[model samples]
Target: MLSSNIFSGPIATDAPPASIGSRKDHPVPRLGIAAAAPIQTNKFYANFFLGNQTAPTYLHPYSVFWAGAKDTSGSWGMAISHIDANQRVYGSETNPVTGTPRYYINPVGISSICISAKELGSTTAVTSDALTAFSARIILRASLQGASVIEFPLVQGSAFVTAVFNGACPLIQTGIFYKTVTRSTKEARPGITKYKLYLEDGTTWLLYAHHTKGDPLDLQIINNGLAQAKGPFYGVIQVAKDPGNADSMYDRTCGVYATDVELSGSAHGEKGTYTFNFKKAGMNLTTTLAMFALPHHQTSFDDQTRDKMTDVKLQTTTKGIAIAVVADSWTMVEPSLPVSIGFVPWLPEAGSISNISSTNKTFIHNIAQQEMKQDILAQTDQPSMYFAGKALAKFAVLIMAIHDILGDNNLAQAGLERLKQAFARFAENKQQYPLVYESAWGGVVSTASYANGNASSDFGNTYYNDHHFHYGYFIYCAAVIGHLDPSWIAANKAYVNMFVRDIANPSPQDKFFPVSRSFDWYHGHSWAHGLIETGDGKDQESSSEDSMHAYAIKMWGNVSGDKKMEARGNLMLAIQARSFPMYYLYTKTNNVQPPNFIGNKVAGILFENKIDHLTYFGPQPEEIEGIHMLPLLPHTPYIRARDFVEEEWNTYFANGRAENIVGGWRGIVYANRATFDPKGAYAFFSTPGFDPSWLDGGASLTWYLCYSAGM
Candidate 1:
């Protein structure tokens, strides 16, 4: 069961400010300036408290923003702001005169901008806390305050209320740094800028230029409590040499910053010495890591009892300049079908909290408890999710949500622990992959399987990339869950700067990827999902399936923290409305002839969607003689809540639909593990917000409530 460590919403805790500064509107800022802001750092341990062998990382957070400037060059600019940071410059395009959003300031010359975030621990030395990874969030805002050379924005963690600099300088440093663009898109203008600053913590930082082309070299280290990340601190700094130029170092890529530097070990007993290297390597930024092993002895998983011990392999680039880690392998995820959590043996005790809470449960406590337990048990034999075995991948989201939703430390920690296990299982046998594989767990799981059991993309591309979109979904889900579980991803803390930057200026309203047809856009329409028929021996055909736009939008929102999901979700609803033709049908199943759908006309829709709906050909076979969830749209609405709730929330937090899924947020499918059923009488709604709110919506709700009540 999830440990009950729901983070619930935002907290009221706050930290003191370190220092504040100001900026002016002179339209230009300088280099070597410094700023300080209140940084809160929090650390917690799960492995020790859980009494489990695996040691996990706790989430740490604090906030910082940059303060820089822009020149009248209409090109020279420096992007800076430490807190409430934004990824795009002048990304906020609001016509103030019209009260309509226009654009953010553009192209600030940034020679060097500083960014930082800290988590303030409530008390010294947390109890029974083990950190698996460490991560942070910084919100940078544009402002002009004062002098004292302070160049970043700081937030009073006490209320999440942002604070501008104390004095006014010509520049705003903390948030986003926009570089000058050599060219602009058909609809947007370009930018150019530069700003640099140093830190009192003895770290040197890099700044962006008006015309940005390269990225800074950095490494993020992940460690469990079993070891502390230690490093000998080996590095080489290279730069462009100029005999006549005395400020040569000022214009070129010279290495300057390193944090948590250790000669041989890290906090929490980690000794994997990750080497830091920064310089011009060929035409791109390059980073190299050299880790030293932990002294822990080997043993089978403390609980899993499997003979295969953990194998964490690290691979180097072809040129041997960069190192890539092939995380531990997941035991067997996809056997012949998706892995159902209800039947995953170890889990079901924890149904999704959101689902259970959303359902109109019985008024009585014991009955409600029993109903919840049975809800999970009832669906034991069902497939893990709709398609693409992404269930396990999305499940990682619950961990992040735990610490935020319920504030149940035990349950939240449990979720995080399980998430680590799932990730390890997902990142398996890297050496076994083909030369060009990129998705994290490509080789470990079968990329594809035919009725004859073959790995051929052509025979069935559905299964081929089934265990896909790991990093993509992980980051996205983390963003949403993080809003609640603020400390999500403390362990295996990756850089979220990419996501943080996109919040203010997300994909513009008009930008879009042209899909071949309704289905072929992302993975073809079938990728959304397929309609399942019960009591039928026939396997599901991908063509009957379609990609759930809601699912995609949900993931994108969670990852980006931008509000673009609503529009995307609404767009999918429109497409689906036409796809299913929503008109009611009173059909005599036995005589419902399946359409060969020759020539254009209705067949055009099928061809456009790339669905082989014609596979059944001719009259629809009268097999079940019962009503099942079929598509008039994208996804099949859940007729059962068992899919949403599991024991604690392994299923719920990872879920996508509210009526058909948990929070109507996460996707309806899982990845890397579909090698994996249900009951009761009653009705349930399919699409609540979009579908007919009166009849179809009401009936679907009625059925779902009955199922939840265990009627």
Candidate 2:
């Protein structure tokens, strides 16, 4: 009875997703100053402005934070820290000196340089403004003086921490205490002043001050390792760590400060390219821009951009060393994206669904029919949006398989009607824990956490945690519904689009939501941590789910006929395919992670400060590896390589070891193994008397069988 045209006309590209009835203001308490414009809840620099505001925000090679200047003689400034690879302290479980290690950590380093203003004191107030995906501008003002002194631009991947003095003399100080201060008088360029600062630990840094008003650079080194510049300075002051041969490379990019980053990406057919253009600010433009590229970025950089890479390298806490590149813009290309992947099992090369055997098709159909007869309302009516959404998505996949793969239109229709009703409970905001569009942080969130005053309720939904992972399943469900019954899209377009905008709003032009709220363009992946402040910084646990979220976006875009969104989704998937292996999914040959650490196969719970070989729930080998393998969708094989899967299987789940594992984890490991051994997976799922409990709430037997058999 649910028969309808699947491919519908494209919706209006500019039409924003409706906020729906959940636009009511939430009563939950939120910390930090509220922004008049939409606030970015999930971003790299959010730790700086949110919570205590003193926690360091990691920007790869360099990190900066507000110190409050309580200890340093009332000198209010942002503390800058850059730790070397040799400075990493190994975990107690493993030792790098004598034997292989289990973990490594790089604690927050001592500030080498603190850029302040001569006018700033203990009473200076600090606030962040102009926050974007890749940048945050820190403003320091003296409340009594009623004048702003300086603004520090903190970018995610920029090498230099820039200070723009606004009518205040620049005061450069070091917490570690400077051993020597050598002022560079080499007439490198007009209106440019350079200073070489030496620390007690033999660490050297270069400070380049560009004067727009032609003021003479008379920065005097005062007592206690403090340096002060002369009056009414209105120009840029940038500082960078001396990478050994600093005089030549530092001079090329000292004057030009990368204040922000502009991200643009495009996907054409199977090829995808995403570009990061460093928004340069300062007096100099003739010279090239000097910015640090992460290891993943460097590996994917085009030949033209890759050639500009310098030998200078800086160690990051978790992502290995970042290489310094002399270029204004860097574009990474992925020539083979799984653009053809869809709701069904698809082969990228053939650009179509894989041929499934007749026996396997009947086997999948019997399982799907049996699973579809279960009580949908009982499973999907849970209070938690995460679990409820997962159930809804599970059933949606089953219905799709019945129709598309099984060619059983009548059964698919019956199951789809039940699914639509279950989804209606969510779309109408009638679920037990409905969503509310909280304007304070700007996104739709579950009322469960807001009402209960529990931060961990529904996995911190009210606090903007895991928005991508929570809402992505619902989006995928809606996409499948739209694909099956095109008539459904008209009524639910606004509701489903709201979820998309919440997680992956593509443009700032949309005022309702933050642009790319979860995805970090500079890092080539999305971070799950939000609002909650941690010493380690933002982290993402499930690389597979991260890629699945992107695949959902691609499918939703495809069904909705939003070419740009579809293309962006394809591009994001490509980036994740490249980035996940380097940072999260560790193959035996992966040199990106530490040699001792890579033995863990998968980078369990990758944090900015440390990589623990475990998950939040449990430390079991299955749990550690299974978190990234669940809810395996169509394009999973594209991101998760066969080599890594095989290596991981041999490491943990080889020789029937997976069979012994209890609960849903066993299914996850086997589902992941399907990427390499489809025959084995097909046999496992197709076997009679299979335990239904093995499947996760988000997974279905129909999908597992179709995926394996088609492959």
Candidate 3:
């Protein structure tokens, strides 16, 4: 939330005029209060507003055709008037070619006036209540009007209908009405642009103003000029054209308002002082009051506790730069996993039979070394039990292999120690980590550990989704630890087996846990959602994670000497290779293997009933194509189609390698390509400006090296 306080009075009688413009057209004779005439041609006039509730109202009824001119001086002005609904003597503001007025102008109801050098063109209008309806206009005019500034009150007998101003300045400002007992400003902080405007009159009325790089137009308005209010009344105004389509002024525009206008803690000139706070309510001539008075509505949060935790502090520095310190306290938790057994053979020993070029091997080794250094230096005291666990496990595997190749006992010991600590945390249930062993289900379950603390803080949130994806890293880590220290596997095998059972249990006899809940026996690949209902149906976001689950099971089976588990893993891989290309990855417009979901392009997320060729995070080509190749690194041999890999590479990766490849994704793309085009993969990884930060901690040097050697 973001807010700014403003405390000023209504426009003074002697205030300066907005701007001056040279006369462009001949001045017409003033019309009397009562006059009428027939309609005229070659003229355009619109009825902006006409109603009679508390008072008669009419705004911008006159037509100024050439008002959009960009010349030095032109006709630039706005007039607002109110007439009784039954007033028939005054005709429309249309004149004949002879320059004779056809209707009378109601001088008695005229409320506010503004003038400028710029012409106003392309006027749009919207009218709606807060919750059900909203009406506004995006007026596009020459930028020159920004210099003009003037404001005045529209009084009808004893009452002031509204205060109108020459809001046609560099930044457009309007008026709003709000009443509250208390008001304050929220501070600013890195990566977060937030301000708070809270109204404390029984029901809380908050108006949050935010400006950030993601929204450029709003940023421009904030930089140029925000809103300024008078007295205690809140004023609503619109500023800046919509950034989405600048060419079309009729689109969205930035809205700014002040509630319970007041200045506290500091004076205008002094370093730290106090100012006045106003409390009055009879003026109704502002746009702000009209907009917010309607009913307000918002979507309910799934978890109320998941709201942001923010801190705000306002202070003026010695240099008089008023700074507000603010911060958000919500953070994500990382996942954990133990080393597994099947990864041992992939670990390169000293002087092992190697087919990879020294150059490619050196590039892979450098990436591994850099990633290990980052992990070693990182504070693992607080880990996000699921995602981060995969990264940590990859680090352990890479370091163990690096130790074998370089004979660095210290590096291997450090990796082992980290794994031990991570394993102990899960086993002993330290820090109330959410990993639970459900004896009834005969498996281990991860609650909403990744969710921090929210309403969906349970396994049910993810439902049957990603169990294999989440548990695969843990299974792989346990196998690695078993390879290094056989006794450790014996002590932890029971705990490790629980995760394996959760993902790969063949039968449904357990009752508590579903039989292969995520993996679809019919589709041959796992779905990412089992609990949440998307109207379109259940879908899997990451196919790579789906394959990794099966690979982890196979690896775990190898180390634990469970032939049935190992065979199941192999079967799952074979099924995925055949079904994935036909359904998930498409080379042709029509393929029937997956049935009813075939398409010309790969489905970013494949659902039971539909295929959306869009990634959940964004629409980047890498997000769509890169995900399919990620699982290929550890499960390279399982991908039987070299042609499919070639097609994917040629489609998205070949031309824009440097432009498209981004953080974490670079490793996945290049490592997967290593199996087919080892030289190209090495070249990309060794590119001069290649960033080490681009390497995903989940990518293993040993896996890359192993795949490169075979290629």
Candidate 4:
């Protein structure tokens, strides 16, 4: 059995026997007002009684009380309780020495239960003597509203038992509760008053009372009084016994009045009024109150700026009132709820490579072998001469692939040495690295603070903006290093895991990072900027880098035996394969696309809510061409539309753009295009006097050769 202490607050000391029944004439503990001074502290009170019909009148040993709030002055108190426990009941007076005296407030308009003492807390078998005694009591207090003395019949034989009042407690309910007052002129019934109150949780409660209908305290005047009052309005609702019924409570006709009307509108200008115009013009008391009390009728809203108003819907029998209540802006709503994600990795199951002739493959191989020799001999011992992690990751990717395809242990060892040096630098001077991993933010800091009091160029960068693009290269390099040297992986897995957690893990439970901040579950792809708020919102400029991120995750997950990561990678690829074509990559005869049609050129950056078909840096030809080339590097078995590749080649590369393509981009574009037109791609690379300087450090001649061979 679970220990009672496992459940905090009030818990039954023992289990009650099954045969327990209600007893009468129990000696009631006298309770008197200990101190009714205006509540001066803004501290939280555990229990405040709000009368709900279904609420229990008597205290239960195991009952958990609803949380209560007191303003700074403590003049007023509001609490919701499902059950009464004699511990510190707010808004009521209690004398500890005599137990209790005076009257008890019960929920006026609802039903309550009378339970036996044994039922309160009995874990063992109940003795006959234990069953004979009653456990609780109830007493009536005189009406504070000038009503006649109220009394209950005294039982002669049994011990006294406490009676509980019942009514709705907005705090105990699951949905939002808020009060709104509007200023527009609306009809006011003489004795009826309407109130729309909100709970801190953002659940709204609509109340209508007929008691003060004809008085100066009617709903309209009350609104005006609150609008003009001294401090923000705070209230306490009281429920008393019905004079007409001895055995039951009154219906909806009971009085519901504000306890402290003095604090209604004070400092009105400082605290703005929350106003609302009901859907209809008048109020329907029964339906409105009933709906507020009904559990099924409750709803919640997300606090998003784009569609804040549409998050909730309020329907009323009569048009709701147009009134406003004074409150601080911070008290209006809650922060946005955590995002929900559904990530399923999809491993590429099928697709065939277009065949390349042996003559072309041999020609491509000769070019790749020569480039590999030069790259291997170019490594330097000096650390400062080495490229940054992002650039180094690219070189590692190419060299590792070259070594694997050609069975060259010399090249593999050379690549391993470079990786080792890179790892050593990161380990020794992690703080100096541009892409420093930040445990506090659960992502890498793109820029670092230098010892010379200068911040790196990318310091204080936003989340996930270029994370995938930057981290993908590193993660891909790590995966390749792990594959080439298992010992290196065993030594560096922890360091490598940081990148994995940043890019793929979707659970906020991770202590080091936020849940998949970059990936958008709604869009079925990742966004680059996570927390950074651009005026236009987050966007992803490099669709290729997006795919590269997934590819790296998939490969690393496979090597690391994390099926979930592999699956996420596949799922990302699958989604991008479909979403990118629809949004980023344009083909002829495209009908369904983002608004503001640009030509068939790929959209360089896609934002969350908007689409800009332009690149971030500008409309450079390489920027447009490279977006389609990056995903082909890893060449995981995922499908890329051949038609799209053909279209890109015809639209951009086929028209002499390849001749002007500089550095690594030339090889990337030509190699990727080789997938479709091997003869043309091979002929271009094989031409005499071709400059090896044209090859990007990230580009792999081995990959070019492999593609030419249809591998």
On lDDT, who's better, 1 or 4? 4
Q: Summarize candidate 2's per-residue lDDT along 1-711 as a digit string, tens digits.
A: 101211122233333334344454544334333255467877777776666667788887888877777434345787888988777877777422224466677867467888887677767766777787778777777753456677877887787888887678777888778888988767446678788898887899988888777585677878756888767787888888986875678777777777777776666667777778888878867677888888788888899999999998888888887888999999888887777788887644544574677888877778887888899988998988889989988998888888988899999999999999999988888899878876666778888876778888898887788888989999999999999999899888888888888888876767777778888888878888887888788888888778878888889988887777777778789888888888999887888887767877777787777877768888688887898887888887788888888998988889878899998887788888888898998888877799988887778988889888877
Q: What Cα-based lDDT does every candidate model obtain? A: 0.21, 0.79, 0.39, 0.37
TM-score result, candidate 2:
0.93
Model 4 segments beyond 4 Å from truth? 1-365, 374-390, 427-440, 446-464, 530-532, 594-598, 636-640
Clashes of each: 190, 0, 56, 81
Q: List model 4 lDDT by residue over 121-149, tens digit each.
A: 11211110100001111212222222111
Error of 2 at 155 (Å): 1.7
| Residue-level lDDT tens digits of model 3 in 445-499 | 4444333543233333223345677677677777667766667876676566666
TM-score for candidate 3, residues paired by index: 0.47
| Clashing pairs in model 2, backbone N/Cα/C closer than 3 A | none
- Ordered from best to worst lDDT, the candidate numbers read 2, 3, 4, 1
- lDDT: which candidate is best? 2
Ranking by TM-score: 2, 4, 3, 1
Residue 182 C-alpha lDDT in model 3? 23
Model 2 has an lDDT value of: 0.79
Question: Residues 325-368, candidate 1, lDDT per residue (tens digit)?
Answer: 11121111111110111101112333322333333322222222
Badly placed stretches (over 4 Å) of model 2 are: 1-19, 22-35, 70-75, 94-102, 230-232, 347-354
Which whole-number lDDT from 0 to 100 does residue 67 have in model 2?
Answer: 72
Candidates' RMSD to native: 26.6, 4.2, 28.2, 23.5
